[model samples]
Target chain A: MGDQLIFTYIVDGDDFTRAGEASSSVKNKLKMLGVDSDVIRKVAIAMYEGEINMVIHADGGTITVSVSDDDITMVLSDSGPGIPDIEKAMQEGYSTAKEEVRSLGFGAGMGLPNMKRFTDEMNIDTVIGQGTTITMKVYL
Target chain B: MTIGEIQRVLDAQFLYGEELSDLDADFVFSADMMSDVLAYGEKCSILMTGLCNSQVVRTAEMLDIVCIIFVRGKMPDANMLSLAMSKGIAILATKHFMFTACGILYEHGLRGGA
Candidate 1:
């Protein structure tokens, strides 16, 4: 790739089954662009976690990905009950997910942490009742 | 171990992915939570989970996990099975609990990821 490859997706909140489509698509695109396998994995995991978070907490949102020679950047924005405590949410294993969500195999409070773990840089912007936006970058 | 051998070990029922179950895998990672599995680097080729959801299949797809074993006699929903099938991921369910199923596989020579 030259400067960067850009991708935009709308995550659907209604269907949990389809939540990972965006991240999967991004992963595929990165692979096709000849990005490193480890880089692709990081993008996939971080974005996949963000996608699920959008569906579970934010009722879906939009994800924008920009791929460049040096790095991959993902911007995820969701309109939901904004995070009340960013610090608490950042702590591993602190989850406010419903029982049904936990049953489906999520809500371990690892979403934000995984995002941070897999990315070179990450930033979160949120309002208590409005929405939240997460930006993450993975160096190639 | 191949998916076929795992089936034989747990005496699991193949819910989908019969063709893929026979593929040999060097390692196995067992977990119900996708986050834990993701945190586990890309070493394990097989995944064992009691959680039945599309996300489980999606997680496998993301991590390049070749097979998923649903323990405790749990079965996947139609959508989940279809998703796994589309990804060429073998799905097997055993009557044994999570720990027992893993123990049987480990005793037989299947090791965790490096």
Candidate 2:
């Protein structure tokens, strides 16, 4: 992975309006790198969902994306209250996001599921009070 | 249908990307929830939603949705318009409710994406 391109961004939780900037940036970079349109789309959607989740629930986070010849890896780490039950959270309609978040057109409980759906591999690591980190890889 | 045709059918107003009016959409997906859009939106699709936020534009950008129809007379704010402009995503605001807008498009033969 010596030639891998790693891009990291600090998601600002204070501005819900700016949540997707990082994901958008990555999509542009992938496009410039001549990644396949379909693969670029999957990475964009997955990372966008993760970015939104961090803004809504985690009050902010760090997203690190690395692009290599074979795949693109995204690590979303947040300091928000960790998910209580991974199984429950994985359910399609289960969400802890506030009503305010729902009013913003999200919190449909599909974030995690959609992320998992778009990526080739996904793993969630969390502790009740500590934080959560979701690592997802999309094969090119 | 082209974004121009859809706009004409719905009598919608263009908030951005008017230059892309001639662009054709392969299909349409209507939903207010960004999650559903992310999960199911397809390429070259037009999104119809009552949600008016930057996220709507962001979601459409992620899914490669070519146009966004803000149904129910919902108008996007400056933040959303700026984002859409940057992404080159067309924005149409229709006074028609979501159901009616979708109905009109479906009746006119704009099926959902494959």
| Predicted structure with the largest TM-score when compared to the true one | 2
Q: Candidate 1 residues A1-140, lDDT tens each?
A: 66667899999999988999998899888888888898888899999999999999999999999987888999999989999999999999999999888888889888899999899999999998899999999998
Model 1 chain B is weakest, by summed lDDT over 10 consecutive residues, at B33-42
lDDT of 2 by residue, B1-114 (tens): 789998899999998988999998768888888898888876547888998888899999998888999999999989789888888999999999988888999999887763
What does candidate 2's lDDT look like per residue over A46-82, in tens digits? 9999999999999999999999889999999999999
Please compute the TM-score of chain B alone for each predicted structure, in the order given: 0.95, 0.95
DockQ of 2: 0.91
Off by over 4 Å in 2: none
The most accurate candidate by DockQ is 2
- Candidate 2 chain A: minimum summed lDDT over ten consecutive residues — where? A1-10
Interface RMSD of each: 0.9, 0.5
**Model 1 stretches with alpha carbons more than 4 Å out:** none
